[model samples]
Target: MSQWFQYDRRIFKYFNYLLVIQIIPLLAISSYLINEINPLLFKKQMLYYGIGAIAFLVTTFIPWRKLIWWFAPLFYTMNLLLLLAVDLVGKTILGAQRWIEIPGTGLTMQPSEFVKVSVIMMLAYLISKKPPLEQGYGLVGFIKLSLVILIPFLLIAKEPDLGTALVLLITGYGILFVIGINWKIWLVLAVAVGLSAPVLFSHLHDYQKKRITDFLGQPSYPVHQALIAIGSGGVEGKDKDEATQTQLKFLPISSIDFIFAYLGERLGFHGMVTVIILYILLILHLFYIAIRN
Candidate 1:
C-alpha cells in the first residue's frame, strides 16, 4: 500500500494537468448531453469511461521505455490479428465493420482505436532506436515503418473509416518528425500526397466522397440538417428539452460524430468554442508530455 501510494504520488505530481482539465469539460458536456437523452446510456458510458481511466492510471506507473520495447511487437501483432478477426466476425455498424463483440460481456472491441495507439508506440520505440538522424537510416527502417503503418492503415480504411486512417498517417508522420527525419523527405511525401489526391478521390466509396463534398456545400440531407442545427443555435442555444427534440428530429448522428453539432445546438457558439479550446489544450498537453519524456 505504501509503494502504491508513492507510485501514484510520483505520477500525478508530473501528470498533465491541462489534459485533465480539458478532458473534464469534454466528459461533463458529453455526460450531460447523454444523460438528457437517455439516463441508462449515460450510466453505461460512465462505467466504460471508469474502466478505461483505471486501466490508463494503472499502466502509467510501468516504465514507458520498458513497456514500449517489450510490448511493441506484441501489440503490433495483436492488432493485426484483431483486424483479421474483425474481417472475419466483426459487427457491422452504419456500413462499417470496425468492432468485434466480446461474448457474454455485450461489449464491442474497436480494434482500430487500439491499432492507433499501438502503431504510435511501436513507431516511437523503433525510431528512438534508429541510427543518427543525420546519417539517413537507409531504406530498411523506412520500409519497416511503412509496412507497420500500412497494415493497419489498409485494414482501417477497409473498415471505411477514412478519418481514422488519416489520423494514423498523421501520427506516423508526427513520430517520424519527432525522430528528426529530414524535411526533404516530408516535402516529397507531401508532394506525393498532393499528386495522388485525384486518384484517391476517385477510389473513395461514393458516400465517403459525398460526405466531403457535402461538407463543402453539396446538397445532402446530413449536411443540410447539420447546417440547420448550427444556424438555429444563433449565438445562444435553445433550452435543453427543445435542443434534444431538435437534435432527435433532425441531426442524423446526434450522439457520435455529430455530437459536436448537438452540443452547438444545445449549448451554442460559446459552448462549441469551449469544447474546441479543450481539445486544443489537451493536444498541446499531450505533445508537451511526449516531448518531455
Candidate 2:
C-alpha cells in the first residue's frame, strides 16, 4: 500500500496538473451542451468518461519512452495495416469509409486516429536516437524522416479523410519544426509547398474544394448561423428560453463544433473570455513543461 502510494505521489508530482485542471471546464461545458440536447446523452457521456478515465490511467502508468523506442515501428506498421484493411473489409458511414468494425463485436474504431499517435511515437524514437545535426538533418536523414511522416499521411489521405490527413501532416511537421530543422530546408520546403499549392488544390475532392471555396468565399450554413448566435450574444447572454439560435436548433451540431458560439449565446462575452483564458493558460503550461522536461 505504501509503495503504491509513493508511486501515485510521484506521478502526481510530475503530471501536468494545469492541463488536467482544464478538464473541469471542458466536462462542464460538454455536459451543459449535451444536457440541453438530450439528457440521456449526458448520461452516456458520463459513462464514456468513466471508460476514458481508465484508459488514461493505464496509459499514464506505462513506461512509454522505452516502449515507444522499442515498439514504435511495430505498432506503426500494425496501424498502417489496419488502415489498409479499412479499404478491404471496413464499414462505411456518412459517405466516407474511415471506420473498421471489430469482428464479433458492436464496437468500431477509426484507425486514422491511432495513426496520429503512432506517427509521433515513431518520430520521437527516430529523432531522439539520431539527434539533428547543427546544420539540421541532411538529405539522407530528411528522406528517412519524410518517409516516416508521408507514409501515414498518404495512407490517411487515401482514406479520403483529408482533414485528418492534413492534421497528421501538419502536426508531424510541426513536431519537426519545434524540435529544430535546418532553416534552409524549411525555406525550400515552404517555397515548394507554395508553388505546389494550386496543383494540390486542384487534386482535392469536390467536397473538399467546396469547403475551401466556401471558407474563402462566404461563411457556409453553420458558420453563418453560428455567427448570428455570436452576434446575438452581445455582452451578457440570454436565458435558455431566450437563446433562440441554440434552443430552437438554428445552430445544429453546436455542441460539437460551435460550442463556443453556443457558449457565447448562453453566457455571453464573459464566458467566451474565460474559456479562451483557460486554453491560453493550458498552452503556456504545456510550453513550460516542454522546456522544463
Indicate which candidate wins on lDDT: 2
Clashing pairs in 2: none
User: Model 1 reaches what TM-score against the true structure?
Assistant: 0.87
Candidate 1 achieves a global lDDT of: 0.79
Candidate 2 off by > 4 Å: 1-9, 38-44, 102-107
Instruction: List pairs with backbone clashes in candidate 1.
Output: none
Worst 10 residues of 2 by lDDT: 1-10
lDDT by residue (223-278, candidate 2, tens digit) is 89999998899888888788899888899777667888888888899888888888
Each candidate: what lDDT? 0.79, 0.84
